[model samples]
Target: MKKIIILFVAVLLLASCENQEKVNKKADISTITAESITQVINELNASNSGIDKFLMEKGVKHVANLWRDSDGSEEEFKAFCKKNYIADVTERELVFQKISRNIEIITGNFNKITLELLEPVHLNTFEQHAIDNEFGAYSVDSHWMNDFYQNKIAFIIALNFPPFSLEEKEANAKEWTRKQWAYARLGDYFTARVPAELLQEAGKAAANSDVYIMDYNIHVGHLTDAAGNRFFPEDKVLLSHWNLRDEIKANYANTNDGLEKQKMIYQVMQRIISQEIPEKVINNGKLEWDPYTNMVYENGKTIEATPEPNERYQQILNNFHANKAIDAYYPDQNTFIKRQYDGAKEISAEATEKIFTDFLRSDETKKVGALIKQRLGRDLEPFDIWYDGFKARSGMDESKLDAQTRKLYPNAVALEADLPNLLVKLGYDKERAQWLGDHIAVDPARGSGHAWGGAAKGQKAHLRTRISEKGMDYKGYNIAVHEFGHNVEQTISLYDVDNFVMNGVPNTAFTEALAFIFQKRDMLLLGITDDSPQKEALKKLDLFWSAYEIMGVSVLDIRMWKWLYENPEADATQLRDATMQIAKEVWNEFYAPVYGVKDQTILAVYSHMLNSPLYLSNYAFGNVIEFQLEQQLKGKSFPTEVDRIFKQGRLTPNQWMVEATGNDLSATPLLNAAKEALEELK
Candidate 1:
C-alpha cells in the first residue's frame, strides 16, 4: 500500500530529541534569568535534603527555557518550580502515573475527534464536500498545548521529568528503568510552545494536500497510443501514483502486452512528472489522452488542452511554508528536516543518507540489477526499478489473483470477518487472532490504504484500504495485508507494552517493517505456499532489490527537501524544475549504470513527495528492518517472535533492532544475504 503517515500519532510520539540551544529571539520571551533558575534549583535541593541534584538543575533550567513573560516574573517562576518539582521518589512515581493517565485521556479523545471529522474526507462512506475539507483541516487539539500551559500541567511535567536529548536517551537507556523512559517521553510534550494557530495552519495544509492526493485519479482506460489503441478496460481508473505504479507492477504478469503497457505507463508517468499532462484528463473519464503526444481527444476529435498547473509542486510548497511558519518555535531543531530526522525518526539526516547511499553503491545492487536484466532478457527501463519478478506471484496471472481476492473479499466486511482466519494462517492461535481482529476496525478508504493506530487501549486501530463497488481486488487485498501488519504491531505495542507513553514502534519504519512481513505472506494466507527450494534465496533477493529501488527514491526525497530549504522563496514552477533535476541526478548516480539509462525522472513520481514529506526513507528503512527481522524469525515461532519484538515499544531504532534481532540496523545483513542468494541462484 502507498501509505500516509498518521500525523496525530507522530505528534504524540515526539521524544524531544535535542537539548535547549542558546535562547533565540523566540525563546528570549522568557523573563526568568539563569541566576534565578540556579537559585531555585539550589533552594529546592537544599530543602529536599536527599533530592537528585542533577534533576534539580536540569529541571529548573528546562522550565526556564520554556518559561515566557506570560508564565510569570523571575520570583514567580522560581516559586512555581519549587512548588511543582517532586523530589521524593515515591511521590515522583505517583505524579508520573497520574500525568501519563491524563495525557492518554486528552490525546486519545483528541485522536478520536480527528478520526471522526476526517471520516468523510478519508473514508469512502460519504461524498466529499467543501465542508468535509474544512472539518478535516480543523485541529481540535491545537489549543491543548496552550491550555496545558495555562493550567501549569505543562510546566509540572517539564519540571518533574526534564526532557532528554537523543544522545542522553541512547546513553542512559541501557541503565534506566521502564518508568524512567516513560518520564523522558512525558518531558517531550512541552519542549516547544508553538502557538495554537501555527499548529492549526500546519494541520490545514497537510489535510488539504491529503485531500488533493486522495482525489487525484487517472482514467487509464481513456489513455491511448498514437494509433488510438487503448490497452486497459474501459472502466479502469487508477490513482496517481499509487495505483498507477501498482498497475505497472501488475503488467509484469501480462506475457504478451506487459512490456508495451509498462512503456505506455512510463510515458504517462513522465507526463505527470513534467506537469505536461492535460488538466482535463485528471480524474475525468470524459476525455481520452495520448500521453506520448500530450494531446487530448473528445469524442474522437482532438481538443485543445491546457496542462495541469503546478498544483503538485504547490502542495509541496504549502507543506514547506506550514513547517517554516513554526520553525522559530523549535530552537534546537529549527528546520522541518531536522525535526523529522532527529526528533521524529531519532536518526540524524547524515546517518540516514550514508546508510542509503552505501546500500545504493553496493556491489550487490549491480549484481541484482544484472540478474534482473538477465531474467527479463533485455536492458531495463527506468520503470524496471519496480520489477516484480522475484516474488512467487510475479509471473502468476494477476487477473486470476484478483478474481480469487474478489470472491474471498466481496466487501470490506468480508475481509474484516476473515482477519482472524488470516492471522491463524500465520501461526497465531485462534484466541489471540480473534483478540487482534476484534481490536482492528477495517474501513474502505478514498485514497490508497493506510494504517491508523489507536492512541489508547480499547480504542481500535483502523485499517483503511481502497475497495471498489464490485469487490476488493488483488491490489487492494495486497495493501490490506500490509496494513493489517501495522494494526497487529499497533495492537501489540499499545496493549502489551510496559509503558503507556511508549505505545508504538521506534518509528513508522518499524511498523512498516511488520507490514512488509505480513505482505510477503499474502499468498501463503490464501494457501498458495512457495515451497521452492530456492525460496529463501528469492526472498533475500526480493528484499535487497526492493531496498535498492526505494533507497534511491528516498535519497531524492531528502535532496528535494534540502533544495526547498535552500530556495525557500521559490514558487511552484521553480520547485518543480528543481525536484525534476534532483530526481534525475539521483537516478544517474545509483540507477543509470544498472538500467543503462540516465536522467530518468521516474523516481520523482511517488505520491508521497507531495503529501507525506520525508516519509520515503521509512519505507527504505522498513525494508532493511524487515530483512533483519526475517533473518531472526528463520527458525523461531513467527507469532511468538513478532509479539515479543514489537512489544519492545518505542526504543530508539538501533536499540529496538538489537533487542529484536541481536544486530544493529544496517544494510550489511541484506547485502550479505543478497550475495549468498546470487550464488544459490547461479
Candidate 2:
C-alpha cells in the first residue's frame, strides 16, 4: 500500500472550507459577541501590560471564533479567558509543556486503541467477523475534542497560543524558534469545532472504504483466455491495484510471454475501472473470470453475473459526503481539499498540481519513454506506463527471488527478527539498528503492507505486511523493506525531536521519501550488489520512470477531486463517469504521446483514490524528494544523514528539504539528473 498509518484523531480534527455566510447558516455554533471578545482582550492586556498586544488580540479572536453556546455564556467565556491566559513567557511555556505532555498521552493511547480494534480487520491473525467492521469503524476519540472545549482546555490553548494561518507560518518561519513552531501547531488544533457526530460518521465512511479495498482480491489463477489457457499459478490471488500492478512488474522476467500476461492484467484493470467485473468473481476463487469478455462461469457452466454496481465509486462518494458534512464547521478552511493540502500536507494544492503537471509534461518524460521503447524493441502499449525495465531487477527470475525471500523470511516474526540486521546493512551501527528494531513491531497484514508510525516515543511503530503460510514472498518482502524505512523515520522523528508536537516529518511524503530510499537498496541488503558501470545512471532512469508513472496517477486523483467538488451532488454512477473521464484526460495529455495510446484508464486503478483521499500526490512528491536526497547522499553516511534529517521534525516541506539537503524540494534536480543519466546510458 502506498498509504502509511493514518492518525484517526488528526483526520477528525481536519476541517475544510465553505462560504462564511453558508457556514454561519448551517451551524452558527460560535455565539461569542464581538464586543465580548474585545472586552476580554482589553481586560487581559490591561492586567498583563507587558504582554504582546497583537498576541492578545489574536488569542481572544481565536477563542471567540470557536466558542459555542454550549460552552458558556458570553460573560463566562470572558471570565474563562481572563482567568486562563498565561501572560508571562515562563508560565506560558509551562502551560505549553503540560498540554503537550497530556496530548501525547491522549493521542498515543487513542492510537493504540485504534490499532488493537483494527487488528482483526487489518491483520490476518484470526477469522474475521461482521462485528469486526463495526468495531474497526468506531471512532473512539470523536468526542475528545468536544470534551476539551466543554472543560475549557481548548479555550486556554487558543487564548494563549492562537493558531497561525499558512501564510503567517511561512512568513514567520525563519524568525520562529522550534518552541514557537510547536506552539503554532497547538494553535492549529481547536480552531475548527466540528461536531462529534460528524467526525464519527466521517471516520465510519473511511473505515468502511478501507475494509472494502483490503478485501477486494482477484483470483488471477481462475482467470483464463477464450482458449482456456491459464497463465498464473492455480493458487495465485492478487489484491486489486497493488498486487496486480506488482504482478505486471514481476512478469517482465517472463521472456516467453511477458507482454501477453501484462496485456491480460491491463484488461483486468480496465474492467475494474469500468465496474464491469463480475461481482461474484471478486474475492471468490470458485468462480472463473475471463476479463476480456467480461464473463463469469460457475462449475464450468456459463452464469449470469451482475456487474459490480458502481460500488467502487460509491466509496468515493461516501467519503466526499462525510467530509462535506464538516465543511461548515471550519471557519478558516471551508473545503476538505484545502484541509488536505494546506492543513494536513502543508502544501497548497495549486503548487502540487503545477509540480506534477510540469514534471509530467517535461521533455525528459518523452525522452525516457523513447529509451524504454528502444529497450523493448516494440511499439509502446498503455500498460507500458508501469514498465519497470530501468530497474536492476528487470529480466531477473522473480520466482527464484520469491523462493529466496520465502526461505529467508518464513513468517512476520522472522522478518521482525532480522529488522536490525537489515538496518545494519544500510550502514547504521549495530546498537542503533537494535534500538530501532526494538521500537518497531511487525505483523501479518490482511491487505497489502503499510507502515503505521507510533504516535509517541514509547509506543512501537507497526510494520504490517502480507505473509502466506508458505512464507513471505518477494512482493511482501519488498513492501516490508519499504515500510521498514517508514518505521525508522517515524521512530527517530518522534523520539529524537526536541518538542512533542514536532514529532513527525513535514508530511507523509517525507516518510515516503525515506521508504523509497530503503526500497532501492533492498537487493544490497540481500547481499546482491550491482558493480555495473551504469548503476548510478540506471538508478536515475528508474527514479525518472517511477516518477512519471505515479505522477500521472497523482494528477488523475487531483482532477477527480476537483470534479467532485464542482459536482458534489453527483451520484455514484456520475462519479464513476467523471473519474474515468478525468483519468483518460490525464492519460491523453501526459501519457498518450509516450505510449502511442490514448484513453487508457490504468491511472484510475489506484485503491487509494477510494480510501485515502488525495494521497496519491504524496507518492509523486516523495519520488522527487527521494531523487534529490539520493543526490545529496552521495558519499555520505546513509544512516547518520537519515537520522539527522528526520530529527529536524515537522517544518514545512521546503524548509525541511533545505535544512536537510541545502536545497528546496523540486523536480528540477531529478529532471536534470535524468537528462544526464540518459546521455550516460546512451
Candidate 3:
C-alpha cells in the first residue's frame, strides 16, 4: 500500500553512489563495441540452437550494457551469457517465476522493515527522539540494488528477461496474457542502477519533507482580527493546507461568520504560499496573529516577526536535485518527469496534459461555474473553487454530522471495527465484507490520513486516519472512508491477483479513483441516504466542479515542474518567484473569468507542490476515472463489478479502462453528464 499512493521510496533508495562509481569505473571498457555485441549474439545463437535470433541479440546487448570492468573482459561477458541463457521458453519462464517469487519476499520484508522504522516519524505516538528521526530517515533497500549487481542477480534478470519499452507495452499489452504481463513486470526490475548513497540521500530528503508537512499546523482559534475578535473555537487546530481548506468548505454551511472565516483562511493560505507568514505563527498557540495585516501579538502587544524565509520552496528544490541526480542512470526515461509518466504512471505526459486541458477549456466548465455563481447569489471568489454545495450532505449542519460521526467512531479502533459493515453497505456479502475488512488495519494518523497498502500477501494494509481524543470528526470520517477504499483496493489487487508482479492498479490515479468513489458515499455509510429527485444531477455537477478546480491546480503543478527543469540552478527564492508567476498565469487563463479575478496565487497553496512533488495531477486524473467508473457501476452490482474490474491488475491505463468500463478514459462522459445536469437543474 505504501507504493500504491505514496511515492516509491524503495525504488528511489536503490539509487546510490556505489552504482554510479561502478558505472564510472567501467567507462574505459571500450572492448564491448556494437560489432562485438553483434558477434557475441551470433556466437550465442549458433551455440544454442533453441535460442532464436531476436532473443540472442536482445539478451547479449542487455548483458553487454550492464557489463563492468569487474564483470570481466568482452569474452567473459559472452561466455557468461552463453552459459546462463535459458534457450527453451519453458525453462526461461521457470527462471522468471523463481526470480519473481524471491523478489516479492525480499521487497515485501523490506517494506515491512521500512514501515516499522518510520512509525515514530509517520505516526503521532510519542515525542520523537533524535535516534527515531535517524531511523526513520534510513532507507533499508539502499544497498539492495548494488548488492544485486555485485552478486550478478541484476545481470541475470536483465540478460534473461529483457525490458520492453513503454511503446512496446502499449502496443502489445492488450494481446498479452496475464503470464506475459507478469514477465514484462519482471523485466522492469533492473532497468536502472543508482547507488546506495544517493538512494539514502533521496530518502532523507523525502523524510524531511514529510516531517515538515506533518508538523505544519495552525492554531486556528488563536487567529485574531483587527478588533482582536476570535472567530474559531479555542481548541481548533488545523493542519495546512488540507485541514485548513476543509475548514473553509465546512464554513460554507455557516451563515453568521462563514465568509469571514473563509476569507481569513484564504489569507493564511496566501501567506504560506508566498512565504510571507510569520515564523512564530505556524503551529504555535502562544501568539495571536492577524493574517490579513501580517501582525503578530502576545497579550495585546505587537511583536516583530520575520517571514518564513522560503523554507517551503527549499524542500522542493532539494527534492528536485535528488531526483535529478538519478536521471543519468535512466537513459531512456531520464528525467523525473519521464519516470513519473512513462515509467511509473505508464501514460504519456502529452496524453495527461491533453486530458486536463480539453476538460478545463470546455464549455462545461463555464456552465458549471455559472451555476455555482447562481447558487451563491453572487460572483465567485477564489475560495469558491472548493464550494461543497453540490454534495448531498452540504445542506446538513456540519456540527450535527460531526456529532453523529464522533459518536459512531470514538477512535481508530471503532472505525476499524466498522469496516466490515461499511463494506456490506457498499453491496458486499457479510462474509466477504468481513474477509476484506480483516485484511485492513486502521490507525490514528499524525497528519491528515493516508492509506498505506501492504506490500505482500498476508500483510494487512494500513489505513491511517486522523482522530482526536474526542473522536473522529465529520471531516476525519469522510477522509477515513476515502482511505478505506484505497485499503480495499490494495488488499484485493495484491492478495487476489493472478501474479505477484501485477499486484496493483495501473497507477496511483486508479487507486485515487476508487477512493473518490467511496468518499462520495460517506453519507451512505453513516445511514444518511439522499432520496432527492435531483440526486443524480447534483452528483454530476459536483464532480464537474471538483474536476474544474483541480484541473487548474494540476496544470499549475505540471507547469511548475517544467519550470524547475528549465531553471535547474534556481535558488529557493528564485524558485518561489517562478512558482508564484506560474500560479498567477494559470489562474488568469483558466480561473479568472470564472471567479471574476486575475493574478490570484491561491492555486500555488497546495502543500503537495512542495512536499509530494508533481502529485496534484493524480487527483484530477482520479476524478475523471471515478466519473467513468461511476457510470459503469450504474445498474450493476457494486461489489461484484469493483472486484471484477480491479482484479484486472496493473494494465495500461487505457486498457484497464476499456476492460472495466467498455470505454477508454475520456472526459466526454463527465462533460456530457454535466451538460445534462445543467439542463435538469434549470
- Alpha-carbon lDDT, every model: 0.89, 0.89, 0.87
Candidate 2: clashing pairs of residues: 16-333, 16-334, 16-335, 17-333, 17-334, 17-335, 18-334
lDDT of 2 by residue, 308-376 (tens): 999999999999999987888876678898889988888998988998899899999889888888988
What are the models' TM-scores?
Answer: 0.96, 0.95, 0.95
lDDT of 2 at 592: 91
Superposed by TM-score, candidate 2 places the C-alpha of residue 194 at a distance from the truth, in angstroms, of 0.9
Per-prediction CA RMSD (Å): 5.4, 4.8, 4.6
Lowest summed lDDT window (length 10), candidate 3: 1-10
Q: How many clashes would you count in candidate 3?
A: 7
Q: What TM-score, to 2 decimals, does candidate 2 have?
A: 0.95
Per-residue error for 47 in candidate 1, Å, reads: 1.2
lDDT of 3 by residue, 385-451 (tens): 8999998888888999989999999988889999999999999999999999999999888889799
Stretches of candidate 3 off by over 4 Å are 1-31, 50-52
* Alpha-carbon shift of residue 476 in model 1 (angstroms): 0.5
**Ranking of all predicted structures according to TM-score, beginning with the best and ending with the worst:** 1, 2, 3
Which candidate do you rate higher for lDDT, 2 or 3?
A: 2
